[model samples]
Target chain A: MDITSPAFKSNVKRALADKQLQRAMGNVKVGFVKKRSAARDKLPEFDQLRDQARDIKDHTLEYLDLYYEIYEQKVREAGGKVHWAATAEDARDIILKICQAHDAKTVTKGKSMIAEEIALNEHLEAAGITPVETDLGEYIIQLRNEPPSHIIGPAIHLNRDQVEASFRRAHDHLPDERSLDEVSELVDEARQVLRQKYIDADVGITGANYLVAETGTSIIVTNEGNGDLTQSLPKVHIVCTSLEKLVPTLEDVSTILRVLARSATGQEFSTYTTLSTGARREGDPDGPEEYHVVILDNGRSDMLGTEFQDMLRCIRCGACMNHCPVYHSVGGHAYGWVYPGPMGSVLTPTLIGVDKAGHLPNASTFCGRCEAVCPMHIPLPKMMRHWREREFEHHLTPRTVRTSLGIWAFLARRPALYHLASSVFIRALKLLAFGRSRLKSVPLAGGWTRHRDLPMPEGRTFQEMWRAGGHE
Target chain B: MSSIDKSKIDTTASRTRILNKLGATLATGKDRDARAEAVKTHLRQHKRNLVPERGNVEGAERIALFRAQAEAVAASVVEVKSADEVPEAITAHLREHNLPARVKHGDDPGLTGLPWGKTPTLERDSGPANGDDAVSLSRAFSAVAETGTLILVSGADNPTTLNFLPENHIVVLDAKDLGGAYEDAWDRVREAYGAGTMPRTVNMISGPSRTADVEQTIQLGAHGPRSLHIIIVNGE
Candidate 1:
């Protein structure tokens, strides 16, 4: 589900052209950026809260293992089962066994990135179980059979007409006489279909926003209430969450929640914050009978003691992604991994494999907005630079980039040669352009000229001006 | 193949886990005593600041105006005096939508009068709020004077799903519940539930479930109620 795949690029490009997607993206501008501003405006104490929130995540991540154990114990005591999964495969297997035990014919799912990491639904489907995504965005993409292009909005790539088409295609009971003209009618029909799936589901799965050690509760925050249904409606409820989601207590969960909605959606809180402990109680009317939490380590535990450990504090608010220029231009799917934007650049290389996702680190313009909006305050660019260094050391960089860097490194040590070569290159480019202001095309620099005009180098190189002006 | 875990993995999940536990253990001490004293302190500090709830609506136009505003957000506005009147309102709303008994569990006694409004026909309230048929009539913990948000919670009385599961949601706000900001509203929730005593879920729904998922079309209730209505009954 990496964003860099040709499949992902095509999906994003298609999404960019989609009328509904544009409409959806416009909401992000208001919902995330503007609402965050409004929420921040109401609180004079907000500045202090950011530092406090950052410190809490930092201190918590400094001892993630201890809290996880406390969380596990509290959950076990609450009549819930906690399975510690060290890999995505472990997590998938744990969920599969639960479904098998239930003899699950159908599964309803809430949005869980860990499930994406393990490719959970595909695995479930392989075993002959029909897994239906309950969230609207997830459901839309499920119809298209595509991976989520964005963390928050999965089907952001689809337009309304396409959605109408998808509903008509999958919804067998759709009346032949039905007019696809009204969007409301289309949405209503989809709702009826999903509502049935929600009830018929044998197993419901979700991701935990935060795992509480004190109460032994797995908390999920969703505006749609789909997550609650995904975990509560079915007989077997499985939580596919990674290890870092654990927060020590309800109080700690509160501090995070205050920042989370503000950072993510600019709301005081999400529409629903469902904290389920184990399963349904004796007299409880609407809830699951069995509950299982699959805590996926998936390289996170190893990251705790390392320089990359700061990444563990991320809350998945998508703030960093929204404010990131590289992400704004290219969108989430371009990052070629589950996580995207600057956070993805730093995280993908480490979690997936530095060499496997090296391009992610290079995708950033390093404007630092991702860090600016990041509640956890991860040093994203620095981590990416560390990856670049590792890539260069391993000679894993593309031959042209490597050769160019090598030449620059050689010249940098010899300033006279550096100036000489830089000047010659500028002169060569000027001659090639032949007084034309912009280069519409360039052979070696096709990556730049592909979608934009290259600004021809103006006047003598900066080195020449500096030397002549007596600055150097 | 089994990989050896860190020695501390046996103790806690990671060092971060240890510090978080210790931090929580410590933060509780810092806030507990002060927080316990906070309720009375807040009650006393803000007692005089409370708004005198006295705007009156004598006619149907005013009722229609309120209902229209609520319906704009996909909420159903019910005009009812007592809890006894709730069942009829629920029935009328369902009938107008032309939906059969879509309610799974009627925590609201208003729903119990309907013969078929029980389980299997049972709509779980924890489910995502959707459906043109699913109608919820809930007691507002507080409403925002500024934004018109209806604050609700999950319990035996109001199913968590009622907030999100229905395309149309009917909330009953006792005009006095209206507050200034989200925090002001939560102060009421805190006053009701306390610092550590949070319900399974608390939903602050301002309008219908909505997503501008397509071209930012501003579609209401993409995942929540397509309509939200709040009825403010005159004082008893």
Candidate 2:
């Protein structure tokens, strides 16, 4: 919950040295990219569905007010309640009150980024209620008291031995010498430990992948059934989600679902895609007795009607980060927020002020793989550029960057001076290179040359070469 | 408990403030009534978007595609001539897995009418699962042939718990209930439960519960059923 984005550079440096994290992040490339490509090849309409999904989100946001009203009415009609929060504190207070009303002692939670945004677990603990994370990845991070590194895979930065260590520390009742070397053993341990917590929990909280206005249902897609168990067995279920997750109809949500799983995990569909409308119906055998939805607008409302509004269209697929070279190299904690990867780079600066998270937008190389693989077709690189421009205007950039950019801007305004300066600079670099075609290092460019050699210029600038080659 | 003043709830204030912010930000001149009308029109149309050619076949071709896709996801399926054969299928499946012949189910009419008496050795109990139940059976409301997804709505007759709380989950469906896409299954839901209203829960189970969280290696039975078995009763 603390803002560490300002230290993104140092975070990245530490992440690069973390051997376990680098090894874990390597799995992202071979796992997600190849599976997604295969899934996309199988479905001929994957690209078309991406366009349709984008339009669906855009249309819903344009008239978000109307959709909210409809969704609220339908929710209430189905014997459910809807709560709106203007900030993270407002949401936390509403949930705490609901838990208090139910006299809840233990609250079980599914993996929700919004919950992390509001810091719900800490709030509930401070109020003397035990909050247990039910998802395997979430449970691991909760035990370690760490923020999630990946949106979907919270424990993606840790190795198996690390998880075994965490389990031994947390579950002292279990025998110390129990075999926990295999992944299956670790999974079984968590499953057994969390099963009773689900039944004992008085309230359950989950995030919605999509909120259908037609049926007022909150949908979640997950491979593990922990979310379903958390919501079903508990006496009360609370959905913590943002306002932008709304869609017009079930058909619209269906269209998006076709692409969501393919892009996220390359599965045709997740093992469990449940649509919960409200509380348990009359004569229902078993389910939550009461249902409530808490919608938060923590700086998201301002994103509407701006160039950054397209960022709101993101479905939180994590595909952008899966395909992101920077994310794979540095890992997610470097982004320093609840969301990580390309989506976090653009969104963190908007939610938490750009002054605090200015380094996130600059971290990208703008290779555009995030935009290329985005199911919603969000222009992530363009939005990051917007953040950079805002930082420049606000004078939040460091003095060195500002001075360099200022000097470049000055020369660009005069084409003749820029050409002359460039040619002279190239000749000097050639002279420094001796007979070699590469410069081992250059003044004020140690950062680049430390990792790889800088190619030397061929004694002439591009302008001279173009003229010599008769291209002009 | 005494009732609190409805107007003083903080959510009401937050709700009003948020809608105001949304109005100011978007600046859409259309009044509330016009926007509501547009939403209503869209809901009324409920038009299906592009349907993939993968599952666009009809009749036996559609059924073949569904079986192929479902099996592709590690879900095993069996076809029988009528409901009379369902018990035998379940018995055979259990025998193969070395699991118990005892199973739990809800009071759904489709499941209740089955000739389960034919398998005298198998024991069937009716109700929701209580964590120890090895296997649970439920009649699917319908299924989407597009992705081999089973559609089950919650009610007293077909409890939602039976779908998740068992190690092995068995779903029986009529061949006529299988449709080409999720849109078709949704139409069936509306016809059964009316528009704008849904059951408490609708589960679209594709395959058995699984997780790839550990090293991105998928392992089945992550706090839910490890195996999902489907029995389709074909029409003569």
Candidate 3:
């Protein structure tokens, strides 16, 4: 909700030293990475499905205007309403107005990144309506008054003891002697507490995984089934989603769904993949009385036809984040935005200005794991590099980086000087090492050497060795 | 106009502005009519992209694959001869789990038509679950044998709450309704409730609800049914 990307350095520093966060983050590698690999292994068509999924998103983005028109027509035909918001403020206003019309005292929410982007909860609170988060991870973060560290696992930065403490503090009305040691017991307590909130809440809001143009349906994939109850028990259902979630048809959604679960959680499918098309039918025994979808543009429309268009295919599966090495070390809060990891690194700059989020793109090691595992085949590293180029063009890069680049560019423009300078530098470094295998610290490269020693260069420069035909 | 009324106009203006911005960004110079037609054709034809090999078998192999996959997700399954055996099978499952014999259900004719009287000890109540109910029953609209998924459409016959509110969900699925892939399940829904329309909710449930949010250790029954027991009635 807050633009702290400018403070990413301090956030990462705090995160690295946080013993509780480091322990909690250990589960991401052990739990998600292995499960995803095994799930991919079982499916022979996973890669093919990724390619087709990418094509589907590409086709949709190319014809986005036509598709949005059709999707709106379908929603209207199905006895539902579609609301559009050009900005985050517009989105927050629309949702608050809807809540006011319903005379809502409390609004229940499923996990929605759009809601976070718009800061809907704070807006509701300001309007005198209590916003309740039903997703377990979202609920824990709501209690702690913290933003989600991870997209899927909002409280991934918090360990069990911290969760136990949060629950005990929040649910003080309950017995103090209750055993909260088991994870199952904690889940049961939250379920019991939130069950009443679902029944009493006046409005329910959920995020869409995919919006089907053919049926005007909103799909949500979840294992907890909180989104289902959030929409089902309430009188009004509002789907807060972005424009890029739309797919052409149910069949297209099926192609993407095949890869979504495997890449996210390594399951064939989530426990509940519910598709809600419209308001309750005439004879329907139980469902919402009204349905509305708020489609937020929020700067995504500008990415079309640009190099960043590939980023629109992202399914928000968190596969890229799970495989990201920087994310593993720093955790998600270090990215200083709602989205975290590699996807956040590229997307944060687009939503927020690149000037504020310049540090995010520079944080990546460019390991390319995010690109390799992305179900939509988004070129995460390439997009980050694009952001870096934008940062450099704007003179947003730090002074030391600019000076080093300027010197390197001056020498690179002259081939003879480049070769001579590199040869001299190599000889000086070799002589300084004095036959040692490594250097513990080096001048002007303390950042690299601070973590580990730099290996010593063999005597000659690479250019000299190549000219002498050392290997050929 | 009032603020609420003005917001209505704002939405239409916002929609136009967003779409126009997208058009400007794209600037592909393609015919709008052709693109709309292509999207319509893609949906009308229901062009399937790829169906995994595991769920693409025929006849007996398909059901077996469905059973294995369902079991892999920790859903218990029982094969019965006919609808007559469904009530008894459900009773046995509830007894094995030491749950109450009373079950809540919706107004599904398929489920209501069963010989529930045969299970004298089982008490059947008709309505949606109220969160206090431990066991609930409904009939699945169709199932996908590929991933062992059950597709249930929401209506008076099968309320959506019965699928989530109860702790133990027992669904009576017909063997005839099980298909080879998700595409086939969609076909069945289209056949029953026409094209370009769907029930308020279509739940494609693969197993009971679960969550790994607490320390990444999955604990079942996070906010929905803890145990999913399916009675596959053959000779439908």
lDDT tens per residue, model 2, A191-286: 899988888899999999989999899999988998999899988899999989999999999999999999999998888899999888888889
Whole-model Cα lDDT of every candidate shown, in order? 0.65, 0.90, 0.90
Model 3 lDDT at residue B234: 79
Fnat of each candidate? 0.16, 0.70, 0.75
**Residue A22 error, candidate 1, Å:** 9.0
Chain A alone, TM-score for each of the models? 0.90, 0.99, 0.98
Residue-level lDDT of model 3, residues A245-290, one tens digit each, is: 9998888999999999999989988889999998888888888888
Residue ranges of candidate 2 with Cα displaced over 4 Å: A470-472, B1-9, B31-34
* CAPRI rating of model 3: medium
Worst 10 residues of 2 chain A by lDDT: A151-160
- Of 1 and 3, the candidate ahead on TM-score is 3
What tens-digit string does per-residue lDDT give for candidate 1 at A12-119?
566466665565555455556776788778655556666666776775564454555566766666566777776677677777877877678999999887888888
lDDT (Cα, 0-100) at A300 in candidate 3: 90
**What is the TM-score of each predicted model, taking all chains together?**
0.76, 0.98, 0.97
In candidate 1 the C-alpha lDDT for residue B187 amounts to: 68
